[model samples]
Target: MTEIEKHQYDVVVIGAGGSGLRAAIAAHEAGAKTAIVCKSLLGKAHTVMAEGGIAAAMGNRWPEDNWEVHFRDTMRGGKMLNNWRMAQLHAQEAPERVQELEDWGALFDRTDDGLISQRDFGGHRYARLAHVGDRTGLEMIRTLQQRAVALGIDVFMECTVTDLFKDGSGAISGAFAYWRETGTFLAFEAPSVVLATGGIGKSFKVTSNSWEYTGDGHALALRAGAALINMEFVQFHPTGMVWPPSVKGLLVTESVRGDGGVLKNSDGERFMFNHIPEFFKAETADTIEEADRWYDDKKNNRRPPELLPRDEVARAINAEIKAGRGSPHGGVFLDIASRRTPEFIHKRLPSMYHQFKELADVDITKEPMEIGPTCHYVMGGVEVDPDTELSAVPGLYAVGECSGGMHGSNRLGGNSLSDLIVFGKRAGEAAAERASSLTERSGVPDDVLAEAEAEALAPFDSKGAENAYTIQADLQQTMNDLVGIIRKADELELSLKEIEALKERAAHLHVDGGRAYNPGWHLSIDIHNMLLVSECIAKAALTREESRGGHTRDDFPGPDPEWGAKNLVLTLNDARDGVDLVEKPLPIMPDELKTFFEDK
Candidate 1:
């Protein structure tokens, strides 16, 4: 038998990323003894690598900009598939959250008035993203990390949570985890658990997320009987490195465009103008005159061509790259050198400049950077009430990139940071309030604990049957091949077969190493979650027969009105199986929205 270990906390938070840290602090402040368990050092979660700014209506640039406008922008940016309540709540609370960060010692870039500055980003109507230059996520994560430490919350670094412990009545009481350094099993008992584990980019071959993003929270929450929604709409950021195949998938920040960069094909033709829709065409500039005019005029008749929604821009770039109009690197160029001074470029986008210089040996201050689409964020995750952020399972809570129904179809460029702050606090508060009500320890079910242990050890017993590296590579290749930017029914069917075979093989995979921070051993376990998540995404993609937001199908081809009105939900159809896709109606905009206009 595997060694058994147990521990307790008032609240056990899985993942020490930005959202997890935020949740722990909130839980601690709510008078719960909270503990944060993570897969890395306390401050090194992928959140620190976020390049764009946090979306907020701080009104530093324009006093007229408010939460209502922020809400409208988010709705339209998401192509109107957003849960309006969550959107509304996120926009309204974001300003306070940004200020809350400042109070916790976050020093955002300042405007002439000595207030936090905002920047223009795709999907947002105004320059409303409060930023710390371009490394806003790093600032946000570090600020929150400091506060979490100051609050005296217990942090378990280098710990991987393998299982969630539930009581006899099916309530989650704690979790089962592992120490990466020593390869030891540790169990955590808490009245409540919050899963803030981020996006699932590692599921694909080419992605912007780090290896940590293997859908751990999605898998854990589902195992604990929670409902996950919208696992289908993974956002493919329009930019990523493209040279060395090993790092071709790292994210290229959107700030390059916001700082006046333009997408150019190998022939040097700007491509975004061709894709703007007729309804937004008048509002969106296709010509240089209009593009220049809109930027200068606040209530301009035309929208800046450079500020096109992320989906439109990404699709346009994809088409250009596919038609053999791409640069030598199978990607397009994002040119910023001609638009700004070297000093300004370095000051505003220091990390981006440094990343390219170090990683790709290209200096952005001189040459245009190469970029292509890469899977970055998942808009679909476990469903929760917009107000409370609680999942279908009573004791289970999800936030950050793990929780879903907030970003509708395609997430807007800068909304993810705000999504983390707004909902992270709500989930923390709700989980704490729920934990407070449970005055006594309900017994942690041993069977559930044992099941988790069994799954974790399957790789050890099966010797030389399969390779972890090969399974992961094949799984990612399969996802990238079939479930990428463009999809077809037959290709998706083929992909499903590959996923099933990978799972069966994973059951017999072998890792010839001790569990002491063995990436191969850990990856063997992470593959299970990725496979589960990939199936839901592919299945949901196959079910939705039309083009809408991030989900585009070549066979069905166009957006269907019926499909537009509903959200795709994934949950357990049976206690024995994993996930099943179902459709739920999206909330209609009230009579006021037509006049108010999203992103107004």
Candidate 2:
């Protein structure tokens, strides 16, 4: 038996992104001993990759904007598939959360009146994103990191949690993990565990997400008997670098379009104007002149077609490329130089300007950018209570991208940042309370610990037949090709068969080299989680049978009224061999809140 180092805490947070930091802080403030375990160094999580900004109805850019209007926009943007309570709470709390970040030393761009300046993003009704150029996420993460350090929260960096342990009563006891640096097995015995781990974007070939996003938290919750909802809705951002094959899926922040960039095609036509759907007909501008004017007068004028919800824009871009109107590199053109001044472009989108100039050799201030749709965010995750962020499993909580029902069928741009803080704090507080309220400390049985340890070391003892990288590449290709933005029943069924075969391959996946700092060993673990998540997505997409939000079924090309009334909730079957998606009615919206849509 290999000896494992063990530590104890009242609350343990997995992931060091925005949500994890905030959760740790909240747990500490609630008078609990808190620890954060992350797979990367502090401040290096994917939160820093966010280029757009935080969404908040601060009424800074448009004074008419408030929580109610923001709520309406969010619910509308989600195609009414959202959990009404979560959407309401998020809309009501996001402004205060943004203000709290500013109070904690986040330096956002300022307006002339000394207020945090806001920017427009797709699906937002107003200029609701508080940002610092195109690097808003960097500022937000830095501020949270400093605050977490000052509060004295213990951080175990470069530690990957492989399994979650449960007590005799089926409650969370702690987690089994290994240090990524030395590959030393370890255990964390905590009464409460908060999973702030992000999404599963890495499962797809073309993705704007980083390596850390492999659905670890989602799989952890599922294996621990938690339900996942809305697994079919995966956001495909409309703008990712396409020309340079090396930086293929690098994100091009929507701030570029928010700051007056327009979408064009090979013929230099502003193609977005020609792709407006009836769903947003009343809200989006159909002409170039109107769109340009809306930037100056957002309250009175309609938004541009380029500012439609991400699902709408991504589909339009895909249609354009398929129609042979794409750029030389198989993408549409995003032209900011033709609309905005060079000084303005450099000042407002400094990071974007440099990213294009240094990487693609295209001067964004003087020319256009070539971009295409890329898998960005998964709107589905472990289903949790809207108020407490508690999963069905006692002592287990989730927030941010790891938790489901917040964004529903589609997540609007800029909403992800706010979702992190709003629920992170709630989950942390709840977790701390749950931990402290326990009458007795729980312990994991020795057999469970031994099993987890053996599973973690299995790759080393494998026959060395299957390469982890090859399996991962095959899985990514299968997902990207069959279960992409547009889906079909035949492809979805094929994806399921492929997933079953991949699972078998993953079972015997082999790794070379010692465990210490071994990339191959790490990938072997990540691929299993990715495979599970991909299977869930494929299963749910096939069950939906209709096109809606981020999930588009090519055979059923329009949103069905019947499907719109229910959400697909996924759970592990009795034998735990596969996922079962059950259709559940949408939570009824309260009459007062439903009035917001009466006018629309």
Candidate 2 residue spans exceeding 4 A from truth: none
| Alpha carbon deviation, residue 220, candidate 1 (Å) | 1.0
Using all chains and alpha carbons, the TM-scores for the candidates as numbered come to 0.96, 0.99
> Of the candidates shown, which would achieve the greatest lDDT relative to the real structure?
2
Q: How many clashes show up per model?
A: 4, 0
Model 1 clash number? 4
lDDT of each: 0.83, 0.92
Candidate that scores best on TM-score = 2
lDDT (Cα, tens digit) per residue for candidate 2, span 1-600: 588888999999999999999999999999999999998899997887787899999999789899998999999999999999999999999999999998999999999999999999989888899999899989989999999999999999999999998888889999999999999898999989999999999999999899899999999998888989999999999999997998998899999998888999999899998889998989899787888788876655599999999999999999999999999999999999988999999899999999999999999988999999999999989989999999999999999898999898999999999999999999999999998898899876677788998898899999858888898899999999999989999999999999999888888888778879898999999988898889999999999989989999999999888999898888877887778789989898999999999867
Model 1: per-residue lDDT, tens digit, 1-600?
476778778888888877888888888899887899998888888776567788888888878889888888788777778888898899889999889999999999999889998888887777888888788889988899999988889889888988777777778788888888888888888878999889899989899898789999998887778877767688888888897677897888887787678888998887777778654575677787777666556566466666777777778889998899998988999988877789989899999899889988999999999999888889899888888778877788888899988888888877888888888888788888888887678756667677778878778878657987899899999999999989999999899889989988887889887878688888888888898888889988988888777887989877788888988887755854457777888877777655667343
What is residue 512's positional error in candidate 2, in angstroms?
2.2
Cα displacement (Å) at residue 263, model 2? 0.3
